[model samples]
Target chain A: MSDGYTESTIEVAGLPIQVLRGGEGPSVLVIHHETGNPGWLEFHNALSGSRDTILPTLPGWDGTERGDWMRSVRDIAAVCSLLLDELGVADVTLVGLGFGGYVAAEMATANQSRLSELVLVNAVGLQPEDGEIRDQFLEAHADYVKSCFADPANFTDLYGEEVSTEQLIAWDANREMTARTAWKPFLYSQTLPHLLRNVTVKTKVIRGTQDTVVPAAVAHQYVSLLGDAQLIELVGGHNLESDAPEALAEAIVA
Target chain B: MHLMYFTEQPMSAYDEHAAEEGVTALLFSNSNFDPVAGSQLYNDRLTEYKLAEEVGVDGIMLNEHHNAPFCMQAKCNIWASVLAGATERVKIVLLGNPLPLADNPIRLAEELAMIDMISGGRLVSGFVRGGGTEQLATGVNPAYNRERFEEAHDLIVEAWTRPGPFRWEGRHYQHRVVNPWALPMQQPHPRIWIPGVLSRETVIWAAKHRYPYIALNTTIEATKRIWQTYDDAANEVGYDPGPENRGYLLRVHVADTTEKAMQNASQFMWMQGEFTGLAHPVWSNPAGYASPRNREALVEVMNGRRPPPRAQSFDNQIENMQIIAGTPDECIRKLRTILEETRPGILALWGNDGRVTHEDSMRCIELLGTEVMPALRDIGAELDLDGPFDSEPPVSISYDEAAKARVASAAAASGD
Candidate 1:
């Protein structure tokens, strides 16, 4: 409709953050992934009809500014809580990516009364005793995240040139920022799973079966740890929200 | 079809800043650039080339490549045709078409002549002996590379110049007639540019023919050796390898000041590093061009012996690559120095380098058009550029029209 979305910059706890708001109806605080832009509002407009969604550009992602003291996961969660307060948005259905999932976990633990529902799409907020978070897809098959849906030609048409070194470095920095705020002993357990008992919100964990970054087995463990959380295995990988937005749309609406 | 598209993403503000000093903008392509979301990189380059006319560039240059990311196009003719269709007021340059590797030189000749006629004669036909991995994939014999290239060159020239139906059978080529109906639009032929990497045969040949010789980007020392050979050959032929006859493509950028230029140029430097420092060997011995001299040189150039100067960024990489990447004042001084050192009639500036933004490139067009070009006018006239090709009328309609016309059954089966 009006394109995916666009955000106006707002200061929360003295930090300048780009807050993406789109769709209509009940507010869903949607935190986008790294490499994701506000252009996603076009997709949201297509799905929600009149449902309103909110996306916050996390600090140091793209060009958004982060506070010097915003260090750990708990710190980011507190900042987001303050951000919601400034926006007068209470009890949001927290949506997140890898680092955003970790922030969502921390927010669910600290502000239990604020979240109505949670959607973690190919999220990475869990730990596994088996292998490390398999980021194999990043280095190996970085070509196609939607090979099943279309063709390599379509992906190139959309993605253009392979991401350059500078862009990659910027991406790496964003991930490190996520790690700084969320990673700790045993990964997602720092707040999630243990905090799962208190998370009364309608939570759904949607993952791509072929996601190399967060293995499907690890996602299964994530669902097992949560109480009454719905789990969905779809087509696509880590960036499945964008890659297979239709499948994700079906998962979210269903 | 091997397609070679030159990604000449220009840096505008920097170019403007450089232009103030009466210097041309430098261009280059980024090797390691891919966006997670949006258009493909080479397509972006095509779009830039298409706009080269409005951008006021002297020539839209392209080169050859295989696996390395520096150049995406293996065959430059495809992009040349695309450019032929897209821009009207800029010279179309296939900075080189490697002659030695082609199994059919006639096809190459036919295509280039078609482009020359198509562009209404504003084509700069560049011939070269392809370097690096191309030699390997094409199965050319290295030892006989020069001979094959020269022979092929002669055959093609004969085809272009010869007026009619004459039989030609040579060591590597045979044609029933020297000339076909698809003659070039130009009275004689489009100007030819010879891009020499390290080939002495290329130098001697260009000098003998008085064709413009452009040295591919290399060390000053290496370039000096090439110039020496070219000059000596010209002397032997009683011709002057003067300013109009020699040129080089340097990676350059410009900005308001030296510091600003350096800061803005980091991406370009990084791109150069990626292009020149590919893990794959840049030069290799392939089957068709089996020349002993070529094979040895290929190994050396591909083995990473070439020392590329470092700049802070791509913007500065333009400067360090012997392009003028400074304020107008500084750029003018640098241009003067390079001109004095090389004494070439043409200064082919490159504004596109790795990771250069479209906005910057557009600015370069403005800067060069309004500033630098005016400065160089004293030395040379505005380049002889023509308008883009006219679209062919619909063949379907014409064919239907012809079909509708009755010919009285060919006058009772009598052939007319």
Candidate 2:
């Protein structure tokens, strides 16, 4: 409940989903990445200053009950849409971060009736024509997290010099959920670019200038494919939300 | 005791430097594979198996791994089929097939059945969850590994035992027609064995199902714990388990001299860390592949809170009996200590791998057959240890005297 947010578990289509809500204005739903929610970050705090920032811990991530029947990203996207409908929120500005961006994009394509704007930060749904999406599962956890940051110190600061066993388990669980959904095509949907053409929301595709995870070409692809989307390159790495929180917050609210 | 021989069938002809550079056996490029050398190694290994049979080893144990040079057998069943044709009297024990990797369990069942028929019912079918890297290579979701493994196992068993054309509606598998024409020659299906290392769940599962649980190269302390778990599970399932339900695999290599044996045995360490790098921790134990408790233990090792078992040096391994190598007499003496401690009904002697020469492997197998195995049989008799053959496997449907008579008469009638 700290950081101007109150946390509660809400049932969405029979599954209990944990959500954090704060601030007051136009609704802004913040979706987390594959490592799961780090909880109430600086960007979250900043975003809550004006807009009503709603952060839901996706099922199988920390604090949320696993949706065992949910097998794909589209299923999760459907769950989120249902969550929004259950929350009774409209014209929601959906801000998806990393893997969350993929889910958000799917949500937009499936049902845009509840959305007003879309912010995809370092998303990984579209396959890059050039360069490859860095495989997080293939690399060691620390190295993978370091690769996500422009400065490794940011990761250290966020996770600390020593990660606890509990944290590692959480990360593993999140990765397991990610693997269950996105392992086959490996973080990118082959038809996501084509699908993005149907996402008619005002979209902002943000990529960190030094992102090693999702290539610049992927960002360009998202922008080119979307009916109303622009690419914003921030001076950070793949984890722009953590490394360049202030700048990322500015872009989200812009 | 039922004594068997095994090797990883390493493709050691590849560049050691390239393998070391890759830092993982799974990711090591196959561009370095030498087909000509691979052919030679394969022939040498097959010859070794034949020699093992001629030398009177009861069985030849084989295992499979994918995308790794450490184990050349991509599918152990394929080798089992070849051995079924190539040799007689030796049980082709697959320890075992990666059940979850098979998209169609019926195909696997049929293949195993063919091997059984070819070998005159000498197939000891085993199932394994497989290494986590296998899941990545085959694109099977790690999260569903256990479910897939259990479902596929059930499906395969049903395919073998039941009059098929039935439907399988399991969570991870769906077979509308569960029919396989090639049923195993063994009545009520071939004997199923389970092999694992430090997986309590697997041990318990094996025990509950009354399958022999083979501990693969685990430390004596770990092996004891595994047996304890198995015994407890067996007790819960209303059975008093005996040594017939237990098996052990040891990296035991014997040669003419102790010095030569030691030298060849050090080759067993070839895949440990020096050359074919150990699987990367993340790749080897992928998310959701292991139980939560096991995953925590692995994380502890990865984070340096606990040292990995691989940290043991070759000399330490030898001292600890994890690796046993000597002249046949010397090996026999050391093996007595292991046999007394574990009292397993089945023992698999992992004879050679890595840079161990074909000549040395042949000599090792010859010596094991001529000296070590006979002595082990004597020790087993003295200790009153009986294998699955001597004492009925708890789970298998018994081939009664009448069934045996029927089979004998059928063989007699088919004879020229």
Candidate 3:
């Protein structure tokens, strides 16, 4: 159990999923972005001190087989529902980043009973009136990776050694999963605004100032939908948890 | 071998400089399209197909692409219908209609059935999953591309064959009353073809059903591998597919002078690369579009590994058979080598790409008609290459026998 966590393989929706769990307080579910594994990050543990943080490496990640049943973001949200059922967690505060944020928003539309407080960090699922979401998959993998960091040089600091094959494979898998669920709408759900009206849970929208992948206006658009929600602009860019883990963690619990 | 003339009908009236902005899914602004030039191109290209029929090619192949200057013909079946009414004694091979993008496969089935009847069983129906940008443009999920493709194919085939008022409930599609009064003139249906590069699943699927698989502008080694994949898959299903089940589509421009043909070949490359530009990696490969199992091989097929030096260069394209450019005799010699190796019965000639002038294309086609045709035909005969015309396709509409059986059963029931 490294960094106050225990890892196990759990069956969710008929697929074996690798899940990471930690913390002693209320349960929290965190859905990660297209790339980067929550288990491999130090900031992921910050929440563990005060809450039970559940992180499951989504399907088509790290050689995980994608269920044919999983064809849309709503489908992935369904898996999250099944995952929560399997975990037997209730009144969960869900935290999501990037693509996961899209899934969380989708989950809120249907599974409002299970979720309480929702934290969306650099969430994608809305199209702003202006500006646009850059296609990260179009950029070079290295360039995309650098964009994920507040300082590009932190790439070397994050992994001092040359990037391993397993890392590359994991990144590819995450990208593939993202495409499966997000490609059609190109990451925005048209009905989400109407659906957001149905979700009564408290919500917080997190953003990094320098993050241009998903522009700040999109975050604002997401905030404008929820009944009880506030937009919190942070100093760091999209990689909020990585660049400002301590502050981001405090803000989530606040 | 049945020779077919094919073109993407690229609209080259656009400014080449605008391409620098970006080509996501090869998506670009339509500001460059001149209605006058585009209208002329449509007429001229159709005229070229007529000339192909006049020159007496066995078939004419057509296809559709969305949101790109690569192919102006986004509705291949419409083009097929036009060709059916406009031409005679030539197979209209629609290589084909992209299935997954269609919201209503029944309508497509009806339209195709009408086209086949109009053409008097001259239609060769082809289905494609479509290009990556297609998903982006149509908002069809790319992850469901293959599944939608398979389900749509099944639904269309069922719509054609099964006595209707039937129901189809699929993951991507649902239909209540799938009955179309319009049916093909062909006994069961017109021939079906699938064009692919290196997707193993596609190869196996085509071979398993014995649908003729056409290899697009791919490398020689890659073509062999894709064909071999098809052959091996066919063998597993207890059938040794003949040349009739395989086809090769290549860019072949033959003029009086080799210099003219080579210069025209540049136009082809310009269309492939510099024009709309390569589809962004994300759009091309949306998440569930491919699995880890076949993704690597598929990418390699798109960008050939172990390609000969200057593989992307124009000269290498000619040497590699990706582009066949030369005098008639030269084209014949090179084409013969390919025929010997691949043994494809359906040879598709892409006579024009990009901005090759209509005059140059006409001259090239005339030369192909006069000089290249006879020699290639002799070689095809020598090699014993037989197309779908010579042998019954591995899979075709079996409506004739079914109709006869229905009549016989009714007569028996009536004691007539």
DockQ, model 3, C-alpha based: 0.38
lDDT of 2: 0.86
For model 2, how does the per-residue alpha-carbon lDDT over B1-416 read when each residue is reduced to its tens digit?
99999999988887678766444456788899889998998899999999999999999999998877788999999899999999989999999999989888889999999999999999999999988888887888888899888999888888887786898888877878887889999978889999998578999999878889999888899899999999998765556678899999999999898899999988887774322225567777778888977877776665556655453788998999999999999999999999999999999999998899988999999999999999999999999789998976544423234434555676678892
Model 2 segments more than 4 A misplaced: B21-24, B273-277, B303-306, B394-416
Which residue pairs show collisions in model 3? A179-B287, B187-B400, B188-B399
Listed in order, the DockQ scores are 0.01, 0.58, 0.38
* Model 3 deviation from the true structure expressed as Cα RMSD, one decimal place: 5.5
lDDT of 1 by residue, A83-142 (tens): 888888776777776556767767777876877778777666667646676431122122
Q: Write the per-residue lDDT of candidate 1 for residues B21-130, one digit (tens) a residue.
A: 22121122222234331245556666666555664566777776543344556688887787777778677777778887888887888898888877877677888877
Model 2 chain A weakest 10-residue run by lDDT:
A136-145
Best by lDDT: 2
Cα lDDT over the full model 3: 0.78
Per-prediction RMSD in angstroms? 24.9, 6.2, 5.5
lDDT of 3 by residue, B105-183 (tens): 9999999999998888899899988876677667776767888899999998888888988889988789888889998
True contacts kept of each: 0.00, 0.65, 0.37
Model 1 residue B71 lDDT score: 52
RMSD of 2: 6.2
- For residue A89, give model 2's deviation from the true position in Å: 0.5
Ranking under lDDT, best-scoring first? 2, 3, 1
lDDT for position A237 in model 2:
91
- TM-scores, each model vs. reference: 0.48, 0.94, 0.88
